[model samples]
Target chain A: MAGLGQTLGRAATWPLTLAARAVDPPLRAWQRRTGTGGMAAVFLAPNLLIFSVFVLVPLVLNFAYSMTGGTGILLGQRPFVGAEQYARLLECQDYTRPITCREDQFWTAVGNTAQFVIFQVSLMVVVSLITALILNRDIRGRSFFRAVFFFPVLLSPVVVGLIWRWILQRQGLLNLIMVKLGLEPEVWLNDRVYAFAATIGVSTWAHMGFYTLILLAGLQAIPRDLYEAAEMDATPPGRVFWRITLPLLGPNLAVVLVLALIRGVQIFDEAYVLTGGGPGTSTLYLTQYIYESGFASLLREPGLAAAASILMGAVLVVLTLIQLWLSRRAEGRKAR
Target chain B: MGRIVLDGITKSFGATQVIHGIDLEIEEGELAVFVGPSGCGKSTLLRLIAGLDRPTSGRIEINGRDVTRASAADRGLAMVFQSYALYPHMTVRQNLSFGLENTRMPKPEIAERIDEAGRMLEIGELMERRPTQLSGGQRQRVAIGRAIVRNPTAFLLDEPLSNLDAELRGTMRAELARLHARLATTMVYVTHDQVEAMTLADKIVVLRGGRIEQVDTPLGLYNRPQNLFVAGFIGAPNMNFFRVRATGGQAELPGGLSLAVPGEGEVTVGIRPQGLHLATGDGPALEVVIRLVEALGAETVVHADAADGTPVVTVLSGQPSLAAGQPIRLAFDADAVHFFGADGMRLEA
Candidate 1:
């Protein structure tokens, strides 16, 4: 009777064991699939979350805000107004009118921002490239000079603006120096033209160091053996710089140009602190215009601000695309 | 044709001296090799001649012009580096034509020269490919072709074949000889390989410890090494040495065996492995116990220990069957023996 009981126990456990083995293949396959899936999701989740909150959601909300009434009410209470805010912004007349349809302040601000971007970005790139070249040379005290040049980049933009404002003030360091040197004191920041130039100069001074460091790093990464070989080939130093170093540094220069352009297009802090977009708004930037329309001014036309923001975003995207296309073309040429 | 005259060339890196006042003349259209161990200043001397580095106190004259301070390009020379140093981004055609382009050579002339060099190097099919696309041997050919298109006064080759494998090195060696013959321009080659030095050099300069030990034709350096260093360095399976003392016009070996002294000194007796013969019955015989026998198809090397356990190598031509641990007697030719003093300088017979 005990032998028969043992036989029955074995017979019953065999099916359970077979069922366990039968479940293993699918379980393993599922585990493998989920493992890869989980790893990929782990890697991508942070970037996706950040992009959704910061970029995608903001872009969608911006478009939504552009199509709504001036007040930033919630979705349920908001009234839809299609394209009217854009029309009003393009045709606004008086500065005090809440939504003037004939004013030119927005366009004037746009023109001023364009001019600032054109001048500041070009000056910044040239200055940074020159500084990078100087710092790249095998001169004594290179590290010290590099630190000195890059120190301005560490300052906050607002602080940099205030420092430059004080320097360019009518009774400030520049006028004081001029008076002490037996020259007439000039109004540097109070005049409209001078204020515009000061804004650009201050912005360039604060930002040139960052680009200089980047360009210097790029220049230093180039192998010294290439230069030695170039010298052996009898190529002049000027030609070597132009043909070899510049072409090889094309990617780095492209990065600098794109960064400077984007920063120039979005300039706001220096204008706000140094000039207050003032001296007749000569140094008013696009971002300042957007800020004034959205929150700073008495009438907060969030819809017009959202439209302007969308336009600026479009311009930035277009500019970035053009840079990307140019980089691709350069890479294609190298591949050939 | 260009001859290099290095006069009192001295170079120092801060406190350490590299080339200590080397004075030599390289004949025009001759392939001269600087053969030395590593850190012996052989490459440094070549760089000095190429004007890549300026000597602290010296003059380098190429084709009778003082170019000690001239740049490498101004010196009218092209170099093939050990690393090959091909521009990774440029095609073979571009690499060969770049220097010419810098000198404002005409487009058609540059093309012609490129084609000529490509044909000469048999790299015509690889002209459009980048250096990264070529094999090691093919890249080496392109490097050589790049130097050839320069039409410079002299060619400075710094261990050009050190990168190739053994079989490819042999082939490239023959190719280099042919290239030199065709060009017939002066060539200064540097290498640590004695075989390369022996086979390729019309004149060889043996350097040690940053000083020239001897400079002579390959056979001259082989047959007439000035010191023990040169003797050991110039030959494969180097000459064997036995410590001995000279007394009463006879050299007393350490084992109490006496042999006639061609010269007198407390000396190191030197005999080439090939110079020793197996004694049959009646000769100046020394009892030896065989340690190892290496049988090559053409010659058999018998490594043995002398009566007093001094290591001796005996090379026997035409197969002589010899076994390990066998007792034998060996004799060395009297004329083939070399005697060096306690100072390691050779004593003239």
Candidate 2:
């Protein structure tokens, strides 16, 4: 057996040894001349080039488009407006009241997006946290229940929106159940407030599974010994939750809050699919407005859409910075 | 005022029964240690007492109150875990006072208790520092301090020193013994380290396969172990065993040495390494070839094999003129020898 294994090992190494004999001298010569920094550059070249082409170029083009006017295909034919689109979006009288502002549709989109973000991210964080805590317990069929909660996240965003659109449409499954339970068969997707609320709920229902999975991972990372120690100390269950579990789950919760906020700010699919910005434009969030301006609606204002997108990107960058700062602070505090 | 009594305690996780039915009593202010090897149910028994785990079939009474179904909080017992499970986010002071605050203890008293425990454990300056800032020994001190701050009926420590380095473990072990000396509480400590058992326990309960092999004082267990497991487990370097068959007032070793042993039929002879001596004061001498020798400053350990290949160990005081592969004849005092029956029960010593 030993001889056979040795023979097999030698046979396996023959091609690799021949390859090494072919390439080893040049590699050694390169290493000797250029060293580790040059090697690292060689390794990093592909990813760096991909990023420059895909991400950096697009970002620079978006910013450049925000400054220019006209729908010309070539960059040379387009005229520079120098923040005129930004100025038009920002021309608000009584900024708190979107109805009183010029370009009130733009202000309405901003207002709706703000409300959607505040409501959606808060509800998403809270509901996901509660779900994570429940699934972390030793309930029967915990894995099955966890998979049930996380199944929606595995679906594509468009599929999620389409599924909810079917469920929440007039004379749909939800209204059918409500009517069977002796509730009024009111319009769900057309009514202004209900349409906005349905968008928030559907979006939350779709994205909650992902956030809950993250928080569950955080919950699992906590040492069971800490809870056992807390039990031995005679700490009340509430105090244990408030003192131990939440504090230890800080970093993951911050990630959830930031991701939810950024995602909420850019919510497009669920609202667009379920309500299509509604009978009165009540559920038209920022990304939908940008989409309509760029492609869908008759007001194909590419420059305005680019400006709105840049502002949305700014909001997302701020949210990300906050997450980084919070997690960094938590890490620093824990380091001692 | 802590006294615990266990009646027919047994614990099983699904089909694997880990703690067998056992009855034991721990008196007030006694420092008892349950000592055993890993998976021997020592920690399980400790958890049962602390109410961290439930016994499958039995009743437990703490301070003469039946707490068989009581929650861990209602049982009023404080436990220090093997990991020194401190709340990482809280300072040492808050870690100590969290339970007290949960009980709605007065502000002054909680502060006073934390201060006293901190000073008692010599961790007064460390009160403001989080547990992450503390070293292993310091964290152990804070864990013990957390238990002390609780001031419960008793303290349950589960391998508290197992996480520390050897030197720190020594320091913490001494500190723990001193803590017991001062508190005089009914403390039930569990550890797999026999040295900790020998040094810190007033009553050492040796367990094997979920059964209590013996329960005695440290010296009592040392001088006379109840069975082979206790004899093998209670000593450092371990007790040496050799097969022997007794005929009337004499026993014959497998290596062909005969000694005056008061037993009949086949039995196992147990002797400590320290019991073996040079052949000067002999009843019977057995020839041994040294296989290995470990020389410490104060004592030297000699590992050797008999003619028929049964292993023998001799621990000599100071340095002996011994080298590996050298043959030497060794003897022991008759009183220092032990005899065990075929069932592993201690027979005539």
Candidate 3:
């Protein structure tokens, strides 16, 4: 039948958007009345609806859960003990020394997360910048090198963590090489500092490729004439890098920094899978602490876990605000 | 001391050679221009002199010092690029001083040079602002100011005014000429706009397809272009060409008219638009059908077609007595005529 063919033909077109076709008339009328911004909003309605349901609802519910007590999954059955879970997280005598805190596990996770973020973020920035600079040059087989640099970013975090875990174990490849070179093998995972270092290195290895890709794009966007002008001025290569390359790459670097900051604060999978909060909790991180307290606990204190996550979010928000301020100042300088 | 000599400089990227070996001498205090259409490698030749690129086979000497292998910085030359290439992050003042400061010059001396360049370029008020804050003309001045602060042996400019609007480009071109007069420094400039070369250069190097078409004074190139390519390229409205049969230094035109040349062969006749006289009563004249008349304020240009459909352009002062779809016979002297042979090479008188 012609009708069946029409329906099948319509269904075959991508994004196979039958719903969009149905709404097209009113959307066009609205666009005619209000212009581009209004039509853009109409196009964005479905995404906004999905985000409100999936992300916003859970965020509000978690805040609600943090103010409650007991094992009840439903909010109506739970008894409210407002601020008690928050107070538990804040019960630190000497905030700098996590061991002195009443909630030692919470403070230990914060301390560990801070150490990991600092080490990982700095290493990530330097390593990615170096890789991006090398890859951006006129080296032979540059596309192949770019793919090689960006390969690990496409990998799953669990796969990345497990692979590193095996390699950093007592009888790993690194130690095997060390032993073959007449050096003693290191007990990498059993030691606290070694385990912490392992986590930072693995996380950097997993994420540096993404940042390198970002920085490489930034490098490409720079006009070649600027470099030529610098060469004309006889600017030394090192000074040119410091003066021209780094300053121009400011916005991309800021994006990498903020994303790394949020990811570091919210990191769980790599450290969790590799260390399992082992070596006397030296590798414990914020998300793993929240995960252990919520579902892995004997009593299953969901409220405590919610409080910890909210605290982590707050720290990330503050860090992001500072980054924005710094980048804005930098952008202002660039304009002048 | 600013004399730069290139002996057999050649450049190639992979298998395709962009610059055939070229030998040239830029005299001290000369404002030399390299002008050609796009892909002519004028900029590449400039880059070779600037030492931003190396020659495949040649020796380059500045003031008799062999600098074929010297880096751009080592060559003590400064360049103003087409994009202006002002450090966007630095203020105008900082841009001028950046190069000087790199050589470990005293801070006070660097400031003195910046002040001098700022005053010379009339950008003193723009010192505190960044490149983005300034207009195109202002950025161009800042770029020039940056070059002046270096006080290098010679200055290289690569189409520094092409980015501006037409009127601004005119102003900048004049300013650049005046700057050269005041500084008396050897300057090598590259541009695709022959007008810029004609108006600015003491010596013009016309190039085509990575080879030098001719090197002469601006009038020397315009009055007597060495070849058909230079004749076509050196004019604004382009030279008019008419196919002609020739024997024994005489050529036959489409309307049974004949022209005398210096040589014998099958040839093409060329005439500048302004070369033809449009007087009602004159000597020998070729009939042309008037197609269109453009009445520009200072001058009027007539576009017409010959009987055989070869396009012809003639320029007259003010408005000329002509109408569309009317036939007019134009007269020109035998001296103004240019003849090219079957090989596309010009026949010199």
Give me the TM-scores of chain B across the candidates. Answer: 0.95, 0.97, 0.97
lDDT of 2 by residue, A1-336 (tens): 999999999999999999989978887777788999877876798999999999999899988988988876456777999999899889888888888776688889988999998988899999999999999999999999988988888888888888888888887888899999999887888888888888889889888989999999989988998998888767778888988999999888988998898889889976787888986889988888888887777656788788888988998899889988877876776555
lDDT (10s digit) by residue, model 3, range B1-349: 5999989988999998999888899999999999998999999999999998999898999999999999998998889999999888789888888888789999989988888998899999999998989999999999999999999899999999899999999999999999999999999999998889999999999988888989999999999988899999998788889878777767767666677766766787899998986847755677889999999978989999988888889988876677889898888877888878788888877
Clashes of each: 6, 0, 0
- What's the lDDT of the predicted structure labeled candidate 1? 0.86
A232-302 per-residue lDDT for model 1 (tens digits):
78989898888778877777788788888988899998779998888877777789989988889898878
Docking class of 2: medium
Clashing pairs in 3: none
TM-score of chain B of 1: 0.95
The deviation in Å at residue B190 for candidate 3 is 0.3
**Candidate 3 ranges with C-alpha deviation above 4 Å:** A1-45, A320-336
lDDT of 3 at B145: 93
Against the reference, the lDDT scores of all candidates come to: 0.86, 0.88, 0.89
Interface alpha-carbon RMSD, every candidate: 2.9, 1.6, 2.0
Which is the better candidate, 1 or 3, if ranked by DockQ?
3
In model 3 chain B, which range of ten residues has the least summed lDDT?
B277-286
